[model samples]
Target chain A: MWRGVTGTARMCCLESLTYSACTRTIWSWRSTIREFVTLNVGRFKMPAKEVSS
Target chain B: MNRKQTSISTCFSYERSLEDLFPLISSAGFTHVSLGAKEPHSSYLSVSRRGDLLQLLHDANLRMDSIHGIRLDLPGALSSLTATAEAAAFLDVPVIVVHASSFDFDPSEFDERLEVVLNTCEALAPVAEDTGVRFALENVLPGPATELVRSALERLPSEHFGFCYDSSHDQIGGPKPFTLLDVLGTRLLALHLSDRIRDHVDHVVPGEGFIDWEKLCEEIRHSAYAGPVSLEVLMNFSGFKDQVEFLRQACRQAERLYPLVFGENAAGL
Candidate 1:
């Protein structure tokens, strides 16, 4: 299961990889980016056991 | 020159029985009379009972003009006003004359005491007003007599409240060469008329002392106040006959100047 997941992610990265070194510039794409992170995690400890009589 | 107006106050000639003194005072031609409601330094001739006093004034055909209560400096000063009003109402008197409380007249102390006096008047004015009697504060303390009276009038601005302008007290404890006409001209409700000599020692006849009775009458007329000018001289020391003579003379002087000094129909003058 881990091998297949890692192989697909490596193929996607190899397919999109590119290097530009020519003096002529390619079409330059400008993009504005905004970022936010949401988190939801909770934990509650058990109430102490009642003392036995 | 205005004719002087005079009335009589029963002090020295006041005896155990008003019946004993009524004839003498009425015979002396006194149309108005004042009763010393309190005991003088020492005198069994007390008019402590109010009913007897009322009957006496009614029988004599004399108007009970004022009831003089002394010892303002004593504890319970307000009680004295109450007692005085009680006696005055019993006698159907329209006015009551009181002296400045002999308590320390220090500006600060006077301010404190005056507050108490004003509070006293606040409680007493309605009582007097209801009975149709007025409380006239007379000046005797050694301060600006007019200012003292002014402070009092300012404190209690009621018609039932006024001043009994005492010339003798003014000459003695108050400002020298005192003329109430200049200071409390209109607020003068009555006159505690007596002559003063050398620091309030002798209650002499009107003209006997340095006080200008002529000027006093002139001011009273000018002020347009028609209150009684009750002569408050002691008869015991002067001899009843001499006192009567002085009183008669005062009346004569008053009548001679009444029309001129006081307008015609001087109802209470």
Candidate 2:
């Protein structure tokens, strides 16, 4: 019974760590995507550069 | 052509696969041409940067009447104006026509937008002055009145900057063409001539439309305008034979009507 409790606790801890890492990775990816979209939006709104042919 | 011919500025509509429009104008007694290049489509072959247009004008014994209708909103807009002006200057066209603002904004917002446009024009004035090219600001439907046009004129008084009086825009605003002409007469440098039904935005050929052509000719003669009277026509009208013949007749009518309305000595007057 003690082994079962300890194993269950260990498994929960591993699952929590895995879930936390995934959340962190997802959060970073979301931020990175946000930054990219923001930069592009800013570029498009600004006046285009002059190109002389 | 028995009579001396005036220049016909081609609108972007002429590129409707009717490639012979220019040649038709040349054959139909036009002595000069003004080519319009809309923004975003400036690189489009019809209005592209190639000097082929200028070359065509040269070969046809026609002088250029400046590149007409370049908006100030596009990327490199000022530079495009500058480049077109440089080309026009080289070709000795002397004037470039552009709208003060495209699309109508609210009257409440006009003052703010006018300030922006005026300030920008102030900045561009030096470039135009330096380059020896006149920048003509035309009136739009919701555009400034003769008063605003004059105020802008007073603020930025450069020889290379002036007003282009477009009859249709003024008529669209419900002003009598003669009164509008009289109001803008002093500052007017170029004329965009077309007949339109008052309160209707259609470009009916001169004399066919309800425009008082008699009064228009009278005003031009009275003002002693030596500049070209550019016929503003819809580009993709059907019946080439009809369009060509109508334009030629309009030219004749304008010539005949000019002397009679303004007096025979008006040309020299």
Candidate 3:
């Protein structure tokens, strides 16, 4: 019974770790996209859109 | 061919400031631009003062070829065109391309809108004469709108009134009973050159659509228009994401079209 309990605790810890890793990945992706736009489009100070044209 | 024969519209860069747009146009090898798409140019209009826009164009080494005017059938069109003429005269731009208000092309409605169109021409005549900025009524739609435009141009005085052919707009409705170039050829002053992808999705780059540039050049050769091959393209259907790249491509395409437009005999406008 104690082994079963330990296993459940381990699973929960693994799931928490996965969730944290996903959050970090998402943040990294957001920053990468922001940087890309700044370096390319924003470099020329362009609109990057038709913007109702 | 003269480099002055090549011009691009400011409509492609409406999102950018007027100051930013001129340099981009210059960098793209265009010596002239059609003042189009109201925004950044309207900002210049709001100021009662003049010479600022002229100075901006001078700095960029560009000239204003034409300005697109508001729909003449709309309310306050006279004042709007007057303001445009005032601006054009101040900037030394010679032509203003005016649109017919309605897109509905049913022939039955021609009678109804006929008076409105003629009145617009009459109203604008004084402004054109005074400002010395010619008004070129552009063909919006084929059926009733074309009739109205034809009637106005026929009945009006040609000294200040003329025709601005928009190839994209004419490409719609398949073919009209009388060709625009056939009927309005003699009075052509300015041109808004672009290709149509579909019915209403227009202003794509030339040679990227179904328009036969070769045949068009033949027809335009007979017309009275002797100005630049001013393009009114937008990046909307061009599949170009970068403004500078789009401008360069447009300039290249316009150059390709120059031989087609000017022919082997005289060179470009």
Which candidate leads the pack in lDDT? 3
Query: In candidate 1, what are the lDDT values of residues B1-269, reduced to their tens digit?
Result: 43233576666564445676666667666777776644552121245555666677778777767777654445676676676676666667778776556522556676766666677778777778667788777766446433566688766765888877766656654335555556666777777676655543445556556666677667776763665666766543232256557566656544554564565655444
Tell me the TM-score of each prediction against the true structure.
0.69, 0.69, 0.78
Instruction: Report the Cα lDDT for residue B253, model 2.
Output: 48
Docking class of 1: incorrect
DockQ of candidate 2 against the true complex: 0.01
What residue runs in model 1 are displaced by over 4 Å at the alpha carbon? A1-53, B1-5, B14-16, B37-48, B70-73, B144-146, B173-179, B235-243, B264-269
lDDT of 2 by residue, A1-53 (tens): 99999999999999999999999999999999999988898566655321100
Chain B, TM-score, each prediction? 0.80, 0.81, 0.91
lDDT of 2 by residue, B30-135 (tens): 6666766443333323344446656665677777666674565445567667666666666677778876654455567557656765776766777777768788
Comparison by DockQ, 1 against 3, better one: 3
Provide the lDDT at B180 for model 2: 58
Model 1 chain A: worst 10 consecutive residues (lDDT sum): A29-38
The TM-score obtained by model 3 is: 0.78
- Whichever of 1 and 3 has more lDDT, that candidate is 3
Q: Which 10-residue window of candidate 1 chain B scores lowest in summed lDDT?
A: B37-46
lDDT of each: 0.61, 0.61, 0.79
The candidates, ranked best first by TM-score, are 3, 2, 1
